[model samples]
Target: MSTLRVRPSTVLFAILAVGGVAFGTTCVEACLGPGRAAVRLARTARLAERLQLTDLCLFTEARYTRHASQADRHAAFQDHPAALEHFPSGSLMPPSGAANRASP
Candidate 1:
């Protein structure tokens, strides 16, 4: 009887693939439920037109200037739902002075 042996490269590739899967699983498991729910609730791209959120979304997720801190900004905006019409209750808050200043 003859046994076949795998090459070194194949072994390395297999290890990397397993690592990637484990890492992805860990992330998904960690982010499910509340983390996922919060993202779904707080991700405002769908509200862009109705809420005039395009500009805000751009700045909120923008790359270089890094004006927004994901953790703190999400927390701040979640607390200040008044500026967003799509908030769960669909109740609106009158634009504050800062919001009014940006009015077109």
Candidate 2:
């Protein structure tokens, strides 16, 4: 009687190949899944347009930094001109155009 033996390297390769296949399947599903939601997304966009909605809010920590266009450059340092930003989002977004221009 002959016994079949699998090498450790072979087992590892087989596991990796299975994982690769699973990852590829997920990618394909993701690519195809968004098509089904296209209509719903379009409808939502139309609703937003009709309502004259503002830009999307990126942060919830502070009202000033929530929307890039609506940000108040001095709001972060309201307590003191040299105070460090209290909200983490302040570090993520750069100063808005109004802040960059020199006041005449």
Best by TM-score: 2
TM-score of 2: 0.70
Give lDDT for model 2.
0.81
Q: Roughly what TM-score does model 1 have, to 2 decimal places?
A: 0.29
- lDDT, candidate 2, 3-54, per-residue tens: 9999999999999999999999999999988898899989988987998866
Q: TM-score per candidate, in order?
A: 0.29, 0.70
List the candidate 1 regions with Cα displacement exceeding 4 Å.
Answer: 1-3, 33-104
* Error at 104, model 2, angstroms: 12
Residues 11-75, model 1: lDDT tens digits: 99999999999999988888786776776666655565567632332232322112222223233
Q: Model 2: which ten-residue window has the lowest total lDDT?
A: 64-73
Clashing pairs in 2: none
| Candidate 2 Cα errors over 4 Å, as ranges | 97-104
Per-residue lDDT of 102 in model 1: 40
In model 2, how large is the Cα lDDT of residue 69? 63
